[model samples]
Target chain A: MRHILSVTVENEPGVLSRVAGLFSGRGFNIESLNVGPTLDTGVSVMTITTEGDEQIIEQIVKQLRKLITVIKVVDLTDLKSVLREMVLLKVNANDANRAEILRTVDIFRCKVVDVSIDELTIEATGNYEKISAIVGLLTRFGIKEISRSGMVAMKRSIQN
Target chain B: MELTGAQILLECLKREGVEVLFGFPGGAVIDIYNELPNTSLKHVLVRHEQAAIHAADGFARASGKVGCCLVTSGPGATNTVTGIATAYMDSIPVVILTGQVPTPLIGNDAFQEVDIVGITRPCTKHNYLVKDVRELAHVIRQAFYLARSGRPGPVLVDLPKDVMQVKTKFVWPDDVKMRSYNPNCKPHSGQIKKVAQLIRDAERPIIYAGGGVITSKAHESLTWLAKNLHIPVTATLMGLGCFPGDDKLWLGMLGMHGTYAANMAINNADLVLAVGARFDDRVTGKVSTFAPMAKLVHIDIDPTSIQKNVSVHVPLVSDCRLALEALKEELAPSLAEYDFEAGHMPWVTKVGVWGKEHPLNYQASETTIKPQSVVEKIHEITKGEAVICTEVGQHQMWTAQFYRFNEPNCFLSSGGLGTMGYGFPAAIGAQFARPDKMVIDIAGDGSIQMNIQEMATSVCNNLGVKIVILNNGYLGMVRQWQELFYKKNYCSTCMDAQPDFVKLAEAYGAAGFRITDPGDLDRVLRQALDTPGTVIVDVRVEREENVYPMVPAGASLTDMLLV
Candidate 1:
């Protein structure tokens, strides 16, 4: 099972290592992690995507709460939330498949951020499935370089 | 008042009621040493940084206060890692202060530089690297608070040389607010009621207590709950002194090296109420088959300690004293009418029968002194009053078996980490903590030599700690394992070429006594105990004698290899 944990912690030095150390020390799997400051300068939030069963996740949450710097841990696995991941991929392109590449990018609603004579850099943002699809189709043109921002998630408000 | 970081550290320590600290001087800590004259704090200059941390640990365990230690960087800080991990494993409250390189030189691999905070992150409950002088006072206060709160563990504060040299206005934070570190100390009323109901319904109930009872000082409540409700009690290696050992309700120690009665009782128990004790692997031989018939209710201060090793039906996260007190109160009214004692008579009788059938025992050897008898003689001499510390190996297990502690904070052994070379220096700390009481370190020949140099520290301070070495000329515990399972290969378990401990003791200006005959055991132990300064009594015992009633690693508690 996959769990997206939203962890709020004190914004201070060594907080990242503490969180990372807990996972590595305890042998818990951490698929992806995103950390940034929050509205309060003294606090930060970390979105961690991890894989574990019900028991391991419970242990992970309890262990994270044990950290003195960690403020709160919310498991957004079951909660309705918005999750996003971005990827910057430069693909090999030439006159022969350039039209074909533009058609695929148009269908996926992605943009060509950079284009050279023999290469085209595509920028795309989506959930796991959508991003995987666009990246998979573009890989046919030979991926020259790639960068990814790991998953960032936020809970949705009850606007309805 | 304007104060240097070094001055503020000492000031906060005194305000926190610290009377003594163990340390060694070094280049990184020169600034603090220079400011030491300004404060009236008592410091014990130790030979090695390891002894400083272990001695501090001994002080904390004996006095139930947070132990403090200071050391220099690099090798000095590294030396304290094993000691810190030992304390961390047993959940002892120890605040360790280490001096680091200057701020600018932290990661540059400067002279005597190391990332101690990074190295100790996994072992420490919490740690701080003071980068600014203004944060020094508050960080010191927080280190003490974190070390002593919740589950209680070792906390390190790394002080850079620049920070210690800088000056700032010191304001003692009266209220230390840590939003992420608040521990839940109250159990839900409904859970207490449920626990009470279980106790009432259980016919063959047992209380499995551990080090938490000692840490939380919940012995009184634990004893009352056991006696008033007619339940048998068993303690872990760390929980030996938490309850009266002679009490009929006591089922002796539990787990791998635990007594036969305790293992059997837990094996057949109907409901096991574990208070302030984690289900350590040693206590539970095979986790899947542990307490085969019991419904477990675990109450511990740390939430993560619950269900970490064993599953429990009822879990309460609160201080051991608070939870036990609540349970006692919850059952108070019902106890006034119902005969709880009468209901558990049969179960207690059954446990008593098991104890008689397969007791913790050994055959009397007239010529060669038995290690178990040596502990028994010590128990007789002390009358269950001396603070007993033991080094790891056979002597440790023997002490745990024979030295029945009647009070809390008396049995200080490295239970969780099982670190060797722990007991002697710890005994030094214990002696300093309780100057009036007789402190004994029941050590092995191999183990005593590990920190035997601390004899100098003991002699210099005139600490009357008796180090009783049960000499068998080999690492008896590992050798026993080789004889039983490894085809008697023995490997490197031999230590026959060690120094003559009596001569070694006299070499350090301490009294020494050696007993080769079994007849002289009592007289020599008594003589050594009577000596004014530190006395090392080395008694030769049977080399091949092994501890029994062990539930071989994966075996269930009921399937013990009893003699």
Candidate 2:
């Protein structure tokens, strides 16, 4: 089963290494990780995705909480949540394939962030599946370069 | 008033009630050593950096306080790694202070520079490298806090030389507030109720305890519960002395090299109440078949320990003492409902049969001494009142099997890391912690020489520690393995050219004794114990002795090689 953990940690040196070291040292496989400064200046939030059974996931969360620099850890696996991943792909787009690429991008609700004489840089932000689909389509045209920001997720607010 | 980082470090240590520190001076810590005499903290200068940490570890285990050590940078910092790992493995609370090259030269590959913090990150519970002088006191406080806090383990504070020399105002914090590292000390009330119900309903229940019981000082609660429930208690190597070895309910130590009765009992048990013990591979043997009949109830403070190697039916994460106390309270209401005596008698009878059928026994020859006889004599002389430390291998097993420990913290050994040369320095530390109690290090010929230089530290300080070396002319445990598994092809297990241990002891200004006959073992041990200072007794035992009831690697606990 796949699980997402939202971890908040103090913005300090070696905090990330401590968090990463716990997972690696214990042989827990980390699927994806996205980390950045949070709204508070002295704190950072990390969204980690991993695959494990209930027992393994529970152990991972508990181990994460054991780090002194870590402030809080929440398993968003069971909660109603929204997840997103962003990918910037540069595809070879000559006259023959430019229209077809734009049509596919429209279908995925993505934007052409940059364009050159023989290349088009497409930017897509959505759930992993959608981003992956766009990348798959762009692969038909030669993908010159690619970069992805790993999954970032949060609990869906119950405003409705 | 302003103070240098070195001054602040001393002030903070004194505030924490630290009277003694074990360390070796080096270039990186010159400033701290310069300021050492200004403070009242007495430092025991160790010959090797590794012994410094081991001594501190032994002190911590004996005193139930965080042990502290200081070492210089580069090789000095690296030497403490094994000791730190040993402490981490056993969950001993130790604070290691390592000197680092100046902050400006940290990554410049300057002389005597190593990233101590980076090196110890995985082994330590927490570690710090103070780049600023203002953070010195706070980091020191945090180091102690983390070292002694929940599920205690070693923590390192790497102090760069420049930071030590910088001046800053020292402000000691009244409290340490770590929001994330709060360990759940109290077990949930509902979980306690469930566990109590299981205990009431269990017909073939066994209490499998470990070092956590000693760490939490939960012997009274554990004893109360075991006595009330009429349950048999089995312990791991580290868990020895947590329960009275003389008690009728005791099944002796369990796992690899454990007694036949303990392994058989755990294998046959239907309900295993595992307290403060992880299911280590050595204890479990073949994990798939270990306690296959039992529905386990694991109570541990560290969440990661539960369901780590084996899945538990009920996992209660809390301090062992707290959990046991809560379970006792919960068991009170239902105590009258269950007829424990009638229900548990049959199981107890079966376990007793197993114990009687395969008791731990060894024949003592009239001409040549056996290692077990030496330990048995030591036990008789000390009456299980002395603090006993052991190095790894066959001697350690003999000590664990033969020594009857009735109190917590009485048995200190490298149970987790199984580090050799751990016993002597550890005994020195234990003596320091318990000045009135007799402390002894039961060592092997192969193990004692690893840190034999510590005899100087012991003699200089008048620690009065006794070292009993079982001189078997071989790395006995590895030799046993070679004899059993490798067709008697002993490779590097032979130590034919060892030193004259008695003379070596005398050279360090300590008394020494040698015994070759079984009859002389008791008298020599008594004489050594009566001596005013440290004494080393070299007992030449049977060269081919082996620890029996052996569970072959990857074999089921039930399949034991009993000779």
Using TM-score as the measure, which candidate wins? 1
Interface RMSD values, listed in order for every candidate = 0.7, 1.3
Report DockQ per prediction, comma-separated: 0.85, 0.68
| Local accuracy of candidate 1 as per-residue lDDT tens digits, B46-116 | 88888999999999999999999999999999999999999999999999999999999989999999999
- Candidate 1 chain B: minimum summed lDDT over ten consecutive residues — where? B554-563
Give me candidate 2's TM-score against the actual structure: 0.97
Considering only chain B, what TM-score does candidate 1 achieve?
0.99
Per-residue lDDT of candidate 1, residues A1-160 (tens digit): 9999999999998999999999999999999999999999999999999999878998999999999999999999888889999999999999999999999989988999998999999999988778889889988899999998888899989623
lDDT tens string, model 2, B368-389? Answer: 8989988988999998899999
Error of 1 at B289 (Å): 0.6
